[model samples]
Target: MTPEGTGRALVVGGGYAGLVTARVLADRFDEVTVLEQDHVTAAPEHRRGTPQSRHPHALLARGADLLEGLFPGLRAELREAGAPVSDFGQFPMLYPAGWSPRVRTGLALQTFSRPLLEAAIRRRVLAHPRVRLLDRTRAERVVLNDARDRVIGVRTTGDALRPADLVVVTTGRNSRLPAGLSTAGLPAPDVLRVDGKLSYTSRVYRRDTASPPDWQASLQATLAPTARRGGTVVALEDDRWLVCLFGADGQSAPTDPAGFAAYADSLANPHIKDVVTRAEPLGSIYRYGGLGGQWRRYDRIRPWPGGLAVLGDALCVLNPLYGHGMTVAVQQAVLLARELDAHGPADACARFQRRSARTLLLPWYLSTSLDLGWRPEGASVQALLARRYLARLLRRIPDDPELYRRFLAVQHMTASPLTLLVPSARGPSARARRGGERS
Candidate 1:
């Protein structure tokens, strides 16, 4: 196959990651097909495959920027669709140390449910001339060449075979790619698991009109290891708020209404309880319990098969509290585009995986460090010390707006984690200096 638009590309799954991957592949492939197991909705409705779509989801500033770049006027379209946009730093936030002062950092976060965002992206991607979405179709295995050295296509159920020059896997956390590789007589990537044992219950509520006019949302983060419970109430498109109450270890927010309220009341901050007490319920409480960080060592898998690549949760699943999953997926999609631009489809798999490892390292470290607190056997001194330093930084955020800005930048995936570890022109305090030494 040639480097430019003359070959077929098959993307497994049609979630946010797969949809974006298809959009990226469409620029280089003559034909691109997205095989999704679940029936995708035309509108933003919950599907059986994605129960977590009912929970609160926010697209970080960086992710929003990339999406807009990929699909022109997307931000404007989302705004027209009633998704509210707020400055990242101006939200009503309650960190471990009191409230964060509102500061206009110029970074904007568009708040909405995952289903709406995925649906919007799906609509846009499936509209392309070269792109086709095969919903309710399962990609069972990868078809390899005679030597078993190159993936030539994918096999679906019903004995259907779709030939492709490149195959991108974005089947999400529960992906069976390892088994598929093993079944193809290939070396399946080794797996690494970090169980946070995190659980949460989420529900939608009608936004209260009586609230302060400037109040857009409230984010109260839990200080892990010390306080295991936290929650957030975010404004959605339809004058509704998505409230999610979370706990680490074995403490799960109950699905029952009364117990849910009690969990909210137990949070260190009052905003969660306030929303639960004042807002009218719009939906039943839904709970999701499987929250863990898992990474497949595809980069470490030497002699990686040609024409095969992995992205999104299939590559690494992070704890959702950091909200890095979608953003990381977007970053990986961009990386895939860059790799394809430089190397084409045949040799892009290993190069893309190697380069994307840099993209996954920081967020993986951040989420796992906090999550390891729940599992003593997996916890390390380095992780504990990193958590302590972060806790101190959070405590100082109310006093230092610049620090909060830097932290926000890192949180949004715009800046490196070193921005938090190293101080700026303001110079480092005794504590920050010590934190740097520790880091």
Candidate 2:
């Protein structure tokens, strides 16, 4: 195997994960080629490749910071494109209990449609002299050496073989890499899945800048069981509001105009309903369903091949309800860069896969533990307890500003989860204990 920074690199899938991965590889590889199945355009529009791009997306604080580092001045660019930035606390969120207190937490949140962000990142990544993008090119499978110990390159759908020293797969949730691996006589990774039977119905509306709403963005978070219906209203570029109403456990929102408005009215919070009633619809409503959390244990495979690494949703896919998918993908790309620097190209593939699994533990736990609540029969005792604790924490967030701030910090992956475990002096539990002492 060649040393790091001295070989050719190939990335399959030129979406968000693939684009970011290519940018990172350009720093170390002599050339980075990205194979995209869709005919990617320079403009910001939804493509057939990513059906979910029509929905709302959150670039959390940590992800924003990492992306800005990777593509310098990206935040400014997005802002210039009219994407609004707000503090975490300023965003109004209606939890299961009630409306969370709005206070300045300093953690930043930038809201935009998925297509806009992807297009912006794609432009920057393609501008790198070492990176090359091939639109409408589909990768069929990885080519291995005679010993089947290392990946030599990838075979395209057109029966063409492209040689590379390293091949990274970022093919998102519906990846075909496993079938190809099995064909090569390699063990497929074990899969763990927890389905909440969630679905999202989204639509874009013209925001009236002349008569702006009280809040820039708002969320009615889904609480399992009784409160399966939820919604969110986020301000996007071009004076548009991206509204998404989601339901869990087969309570999907309707796509028809009248029915869609009715579903919005039925949500626990009225913010989404207000938007639908006031704003003018931009286009047809779109629905994407059958969502679930899936984790492919690629790191657990023994005798893993060299010159191969799986990333993003290809490795682990979280339910989009939590808005962690994009952030986690970006974080994995950052980890890939670090691993390449530490282990070099010859040995980094396997090590990066293992470390990426570790990095996914927190986001996986957060998404699945809450999702398991929809089907209590499938939840273990530990998952049930964690859900109960989180439910209680949500109730406290309305009254305790500090606790709410910490909760947002953890949710955005900016702070450690341990921060949520520490009790605030102003918290109800602490106050109850102090009352007993005073008595």
User: Which lDDT tens digits does candidate 1 get at residues 1-439?
Assistant: 3445778899998888999999888888899999999987799888887777888777778888888899999888888887888898877666655667567888897888788788888899989899999999989988999888788899999978899989999988889999988888878788878886787689898886565446567766766666677888888887888899987776789999999998888775656677798889987999998888999989988788889999999999988988888889999999998888888777888899898889888888888876776665656788778766777787787667778889889988888888787774442343432211211
Q: Give each prediction's root-mean-square deviation over alpha carbons.
A: 4.6, 4.6
* Pairs of colliding residues, candidate 1: none
lDDT of 2 by residue, 207-270 (tens): 9999776677988888776778898999999999999999888999999999999999887566
Question: How many backbone collisions does model 1 have?
Answer: 0
Off by over 4 Å in 1: 1-4, 209-213, 376-381, 424-439
> What are the lDDT scores of the predictions, listed in order?
0.82, 0.86
Per-residue lDDT for 38 in model 2? 96
Global lDDT of model 2: 0.86
How many residue pairs clash (N, CA or C atoms closer than 3 angstroms) in each of the candidate models, in the order given? 0, 0
